[model samples]
Target: MTIQQSYKITPIANLLGRSGSSHLLLGLLTVAPTGTLAISDLTGSIALDLQHAKPHVGKDAAWFCPGMIVLIDGVYEEDHNATTSGLGQTGGIGGTIGGKFIGFSIGGPPCERRNVTVGVSDGVKSENGDVTAGAGFGWVDFLGVGSERATGSKLRRTEQRLLGPDGAHTGTAKMVVCGEVNLDSPSTLEALHKMLRSYATDDADRMPMTVVLMGNFVTHAVMAGGNSGSGGSIEYKEYFNALASVLTEYPALLRRTTLVLVPGDKDPWASAFSAGASAVVPKKGVPDIFTSRVKRAFAEANREAGVKKSGVEGEAVFATNPARISLFGPAHEIVLFRDDISSRLRRTAIRFATLSHDLEQGEPVEADATMMSGGLGTDSSTRENTMDVDTPTPAPAAFPSAESADFETLMARKLVRTVLDQSHLSPFPLSTRPVHWDYASALQLYPLPTTLVLADAEAPAFAVTYEGCHVMNPGRLVREGRGNQIGWLEYDVVSKRGVVKEDML
Candidate 1:
C-alpha cells in the first residue's frame, strides 16, 4: 500500500467532540455485541460506517476479517439526535465512544521484506522516502543460521559463487516439495515411489538438496479407535513400516538428499485425539515412536555409504506442522505449513458490499505479478534473492496463464495479501483457527520469507508471487480427474522460481 501523505492518528476518545472532521485511526476491527462493525483501541471503541468505504488497495485484493488491526481514514459524526445514550454517555467503563466513524479508505499495514527488516537490503526505499538502513532486528538469528550481520556477506558470496553467471549449476540448490502423501493409499504410494525413483536416476551432483514430504499419512485419523491397545495405533505404525520399505529400496536418494517430514491435520497424535477434526496449529510432528522404522532405514543407508550415520549427507527430519528451513545463512528462508487455509478464509471472511461506482476514482493497485516483478523498486540480487530482477529464462510451462482477473488468480491474490499483510498464518479469530499460544510466534511471517509452501489440499495447485514472497501449494498428491497422475512442485533456490509438475502413474 502506498501513502500519499503523512496523517496524524486520532484517538477514538478525541472523536467524541470533533464531529464532521476527518481523522485517521488505527485499531482492531471487531464485531460488537449488537452485530455491528466496530473499531476498538485502548482509548475506546467506536461504531464504524464502512458502507461506501474503499480499501486503499484494490477491492478484491484482500480478505477483510474482524481480527485484523487496520488503518481507517474517515470522519466522525456525533449522535446528538438519538433518544437514548449512544455509547459512553451514561454507560459503564469501557463504553463505546460517541457516534459512528465514517470510513473512506482502509487497509492493513505494509509488510517489510526479510532483507529490509534485517538491515541487509541494499537501500530499499520506505514510504517516507527515507533509506531504511540499520532498522529492525539485524542482530537476531531467528532461524539459528548465524546473525544477519555476522554471516550475511559470507553466505551471499557463496551463493553467487554457486548460482551466479560464473558459478556451477549443480542441482543441489533445488528442492522438491510434495504434499498430501497418504501412506494408506496405494495410488499415493505408487506415485511417491515413481517420483523418488525418477530423482534417484539423477547424477550424484545434480541431486535435489532437499525433498519435503508433507502428510496426511493415512486415509483416516490415526488412533481413531482410541488407546494404545486399539487397532488405530497398530495400523498407523504399519503404514510407517511400509514407508520404510519404500525408502530402503532407494538408499542412494536417502544418502544424497535431506528428507523433511511435516505432519498434516490427519497425522498421528493430533489426528488421533481430534477424531478427524481440525487440530490446533502449529501442531507437533508425527511422533518418533511411529517413525522408528523410517529412521532405521536412514541409518542403514548411511552405514552402507560408509559415512557417519548422523552426518549431514542425508537423513529424515520430523518437523512441526509450521516449520522454517533456512539455507545459505539468511539468504533463503522457506516456511512450510500444512493446512486448509483457503477454505477457512472463505468461511470466516467478512463480506463487504460491492465497491461503489463513485469509489472507482481511487487508484488501482498493480497486479501481483507486476508487484512481484520489481514493484518494490529493489534490485533482485541485492534483496536476498527476490524475483525482482528480470531474467531471460522463460517461466515454467505449468505457471498459470490466466489473466489477472481470473477467479483463481483473484482468490490467490486475496489469500496472499491477507496472510502477508497480517504477517500471521491463520488470521481468523482464535476460535475459528486455533493457534498454540505458546508457539504462536512460530506462525508469524514478519520479515517475510523468500518462499512459502502451504500444503493445502482443498485449494487449487498454484504458485503465486506477491510482494516478493513466493507461495506455492502442490495440492493433493493425486489429481482426481486427471487420470490419477501425481503432481508436486519443484522450487529452484537460485532462480527464485517454483514449477508444478505432474507425472502419469
Candidate 2:
C-alpha cells in the first residue's frame, strides 16, 4: 500500500467469544468479489446492508495496531482490497451467522480522520505499546544493557516499560541456537555429535543452559512422503536412536542443559503437520517420544551402554516454529522463529530501480512502478493479493560508496522494518500466507520480547535492536547443503547481560 492511498477508519469493538446453540441474531460480515464489504444481520433487525469502508489507515492493510479497538459500523470485513457500497450478508453457521464485531465509523469527528504512512512522524498510536511490560524481571536489559526507553514509539502494540522488576537479574548461562539441521544425513549427525562433545571437552562450568536445534530433522524424502512405510519408520527410528545414544554419552550436558527442538516446514509431529497446511504453528512440541517405541529403544540402548538416563527425560523439549523462552519471570524473554520471512519480505516488497543517471550523479533512487487500487462493477470485496512488478529492477551502473552502501543495505533492513512496523510476523495476504486462524495471536508482536531470533536460510547473518527488542537472524545451519552457520548468545543469569555471536559450523 502507498502513502497516497492511505485512509482512516476507526474501530469500535471486537468479537468477544463463540456463539451458543440458541436462536441468536448475528451480524455477518462477508467480503465479496468486487472488493467491497457487506454487513447483514441474521435476525432481520436490519436489512441486508453493504458499504465501501476500509478500516485500515495506511495503504497497507496490516498497519492496524492492537489498541486500535473499534467495531465496525456494520461488520468487519477481512480483505486485501475488497469493498462495497452497502454490506453483503452471509448465512449463519449452526444458527449463528455473526457472533460479534468491533464497530468502526469514518463519519466520526474531524480529528479522528487521519492518514498514516509507514515511517511517517504522524500516525495512529497502538494502546498496547511495550511500556509497563518492561517493568518485569528481565525487561530491563531486554534491549541489551544501557538502552533508553522508546518514547512516542511508532509501533503501539509494543510492551511499555522502562524499568526492570524490583529484584536482581537471574540470567541463564548461555544458549546455542542453531538453524535447520537435517538429521537425515549421517555426516550432519556426526557433525552435531562432535559439536556437543566439544562443548563437554571445553569446560565443565561453561555449560550452555540450552541448545536450541531448529529442524528439518529428516531427509527430503521423509518430509515429502512422510514416515508411513516400513522403511520410512525405520529411518526415523534409527535417526532418533543415534540422537538418544549421543545424549547418553553426554550425561553432564543432558542433566544441566535443556535441548529445545523447534520444527520447520517439513518437521514431523507438529500441529501444522497434522493440519496438513503450512500455517504458522502454535507453541508446542514434537509427538511424545516417551509413549512411542522410540522411548523403549532409547532405554534399551542406554541399558546396553551401561548409562543411566534418568534426568534426560525432561531435557529434550519440542517448541513451536515461533516460540518464546522466558527466563527469570519475564526478566529476560527470548523469541525464536524459524521461517523464510526474509525471502518472503524481499520478494513481496515494492521493487525499485536505481537509475543509471542518479547513480552517476549521486541521487536517491526512486520507485516508478505504478500502484494499482481497484477496478470492477458494484464494489464488492475481493481477495487482495500481494502486488509484484513484472518489470524487473535495472542493475545499478555505479560502484560502491558510503551513500550507496546505505541504499544497498536498505533491502535487508526493509524486511525487519516491515515486520516490526506492522506488528505482524507475516503481513502478506491471508490467501497466499497460511496462519492458524485460532492461533493467530502467535504472530502478534504485542509486548515485544527481550530478544527475537529469526532463523532463516538466507545469507549474511545480522542483528538489530528495535523498540528495545533485540532482533537477530542467525542465518542457517545448512543453506542448500552448502555449509553450516550456528549462533550462540552468552547470557549472564545474574547481571542480565548477554552478547550474540554467529559462527560458521
Candidate 3:
C-alpha cells in the first residue's frame, strides 16, 4: 500500500513567547520538502536562542530541494537600542534549503549585529560548522539623536534666518531618495513598506516638496550589476507595469506624492553597446534602466488620474491641481512655466499707440521760414538784368504816382544811397538795397492751419498784402508774438501784417 504524508505549519509567535526567553525550533521532527518559521511579538519584545537547532537531513541527503528555517522578531520603542546576534543556524549546506532562510527584524532602538557566520561545511570539526549564516538584524531609531532643547534651538535659529526683520515667511523643503529598490526580495519589500508607512505618518504637512531621485532603478538581467551596460533587459513597459503594481498596492501612502526623476550619466541608454560585439538596437524592446522610466511612470499616473498636460517642445507643464506644476528633462536645461503678466504691459502700449495715431491723421504744422537774401541791393543797370521779368514789381515802384515827384526823387536818391551803403554785403545785383526791398514786398505767406514762430528780432518791419486785405504793420512786440514769422518779419495773426517794433528797426 502507498500512502501520502502531510505536515502541519506553525506561526513563529506560537513557538516563541512574548518575552526574550524561548527556544524556537523547526525542521527538527517530521521533516517535509520545504517550510518557514517566524517569531514575532504580540505585545512586546521576543527573543530566542537557536544554537542547538539542526536541519532534518545531513549533507548530500536530499529528499527534494533543500529546506530552510526563518526567524522573525518585532519590537516597539521611542528609540532603537536593541542588539540581535546569532539568530540564524544553517547546517552543512551551501545553497538555499527549503527556499532561502530569511530573517526579519523590525522596530526598536536601532540594533547592530556582530560575529555572525555564513557558508558551506567541509567535514572538519570547526570548518564543517562554518556554513553561511543567513541571519541579520534590522531596527528603527525611534527617537533620533538630538535632545528636545537642541531641536527647539535649531528650529528657532532656522526661522530667524529665513524670516528677517520684516518677518516674511520663506521656506523650502528638499527630499532625496538615493540607492535602488530590490523588487525580487519579499523581505526587502516588507522592510521598505514599513519605512514608507512611517514616513507618511510623520511628514504629511510639508509643502513645496523637492524630491530628487537618483541612481539606477532597474537591474540588468544577465550581468545583474549596477550602472553596467544597456540592452538584454526587459522593456520599460514591463518595468512600468511592475512599478505600477507596487504603487497601486500602496495607494494610501503614495496618492498625493510628487516625484521628480533625474537620469544618471551611467544609465543604460547612455551606453554605446551592451556586449563585446556590435548588435542592432531595439526600440521599446528594452527597459530604460535610468531616471527616464521614473518620469514616464509619473506621466502615466497623471494621465490615469485625469490630469491635464500641456507644453511646447520637449518640456511639459502639468496642471494636476490649480497649482502650477512644470516638469523638465535631463537636468541640463531648465524650463519655466508661469502665469501671464501681459495685462499690466498692455496699458503702456495703448498710450503710445494713441499718440502715434493722432500724429498720423492731423495736418502738418508749419515752422517759421527765415530768409536771408544775400543779393538784395545794387545799381538799377546791374539789378534789372538779374531780376526775373515775371517776378512781381516792387510796391514802391507800382505806387510811384501816389507819391509826389519831389518825394519820389528823394526816395530814389535815398534808395541809391542805401544800395551804395550796403554794397560790401554781396556782388549780386539783386542783393542791392533798393532791389531787395522790391523783392521783399512781393513775398506772400503760405497759408497753414498751424504754425510755430521763434525769433530773436524785436518786431516785424514790413506790411503784408494778400487776399484783398491790405494789412498794415501793427508795431507789435515779436517776443509776445502769436502769429508765425514770414521770413525776417513777425506777422501778426489779428492784424494780418508784418510789423517792426521801434526798438528793432
Candidate 4:
C-alpha cells in the first residue's frame, strides 16, 4: 500500500481544482525535446529557415523552447517604411522599394544603391551585400531564453495529449466557455433553462469537466437603477431569486456541473469598483456569490412544495474576473479575462494594417492583402468583414483624437494580435488606460499562456493561435435584443489546439 493515491490541490481559490473528490495531478503540460540551438521571436527577412534532409546533427530544435525565458541583445531591424495611417490623410508606406526579397514590403522612393553597409553601436560593421538595402536593417541572433517548448499552440496530430486526470485520454476531457449571460434578457434566461433541462435528461455526457460563464449579468439597466431597478428591469435581488427556481428545477445539472463566473465591467455589481479600471480580475466578491440567493430560495420553495430538501446547494464558484487556471504537472496555464479589452486596444494601439485575419504566429503571416484603416466610426461587424478585399467599404472615420471623448476606433481581428505581440493585455499607455499600479504584474502575459480567453461583447467570437498560446473571444449571449446566442471554445490537451465557434443558444 505504499502507492497510496495523492492529489495535489491547486491554489486557485475557486474551482474543482480544490473541491473535486478524486485526488488528481494538476497543471501538467507536455514538453518538447530540449537542445541548444539559436531561436528568435522574429520571422521576416533575417530568420534563417534552417531545414535539413534528415535534420542536421544540431537541428533537432523543435518549436517553442519551453519553460525558459531568455534575453537576446541583437539589434531590432527597424521597419524604416513603417508609417501610421493618420486620420483623414493617406500616408505613403516607408518600407523598402524592392525586387522581391522580404527584408521589407515594397514601398517608398526609388534610388540607386547608396549606403551598401552600416555599422552598429557596437562598432560591428556588416559585409558587402549582407544587408538587403533598406529591406533588412539588422539581423543578429542574440542570447535569449532557451526553454524547450514549441513557439505556438498548434498541435501536430502526432503531438496530442489528454489534459484531465492521469488516466483520461486526449479526446475525452473538454472545457466549455460562454459569456454575456445577461439576466435581463428573457431569451438568455430561457437559453440557460433549456441547456440545464437537456443536460438533466442526458445521463451519458451531460457534464463537461468544467464550464466558464462570463457576465454582464446585471446589464446597464440594473446599474443605472442604483440597484433599485430601472427601465422596468427587475431589481438585482429579484433576478437572483427567480434564477433559483431554474437551478432547482434541474437538480441533476446542479449536481454534476462546476460553474465558474467572472464579472464584466458593465455588470451591475461592478459599477462602483474603483480598484483597477483595466484589470480583469474582479475587485469585489466572486461572481457566483451573487447566485447564493437562488440557492437559499430553492431550499425554501422545495420545503413549501412538500418536497424533501434536494441537498443540492449548487457547487458553484465566485472567482476573479480574470482568474487563472493551472495544470501544474503538465505546466499548462489558462488566463480568463471577461471584459472587452479588444475595444480599448483598437482605440490606442499603434498600427500597420486593419488586421484582415487573426495572425497565427506559429505559421507564416499572409501579407499581400491591403489593410483598410477603418477609423473611429468602425463597428465590430465591419471590422470582421473588412478582410474580404472585394467588399466595398465606406469611408473610414476621421482619425481618433484621444483628448476628444467622442473618439474611439473599433479594430476587429487585429486587436488580439496587437495584444499578444506586445505580451501585455492592456498595451495602451497607462495614462491612456490605467491598470492597478499595485497588481500590474498580475497582468503581464509573458511566456504567453496555454490558453487565453478574452470574453468580449465588442468583438466577434474567434479562436486564434499566437506564440504558442491559444487566444479566444466568446462574444455575448444576447446582442441588440436578439437572444439565444452562445459562444463555444473547445481545447484538446494533447494537441494544444482549440476550436472556437458561436451559434444560437
For candidate 4, write residues 282-302 as lDDT tens digits.
Answer: 344434445677556444444
Write model 1 residue lDDT over 60-100, tens digit each, in one string. Answer: 55666778777778889888876555455535136687679
The candidates, ranked best first by TM-score, are 1, 2, 4, 3
C-alpha lDDT values of all predictions:
0.74, 0.44, 0.25, 0.42
- Candidate 4's error at 52, in angstroms? 41
TM-score result, candidate 4: 0.50
Flag clash pairs in model 1. Answer: none
The deviation in Å at residue 460 for candidate 2 is 3.2
Off by over 4 Å in 4: 1-172, 197-201, 204-206, 221-234, 273-282, 287-289, 294-314, 328-330, 350-413, 479-485, 492-495, 501-505
Comparing 1 and 3 on TM-score, the stronger one: 1
Q: Which runs of model 1 end up more than 4 angstroms from their true locations?
A: 1-5, 54-57, 81-95, 122-134, 161-167, 225-231, 308-312, 354-405
Once fitted onto the true fold, the runs of candidate 3 whose alpha carbons sit more than 4 angstroms away are 1-172, 182-191, 219-231, 235-237, 250-255, 262-266, 271-505
Which of 3 and 4 is ahead in TM-score?
4
* Residue-level error in angstroms, candidate 3, position 132: 62
Clashes of 1: 0
> In candidate 2, residue 207 scores what lDDT?
69
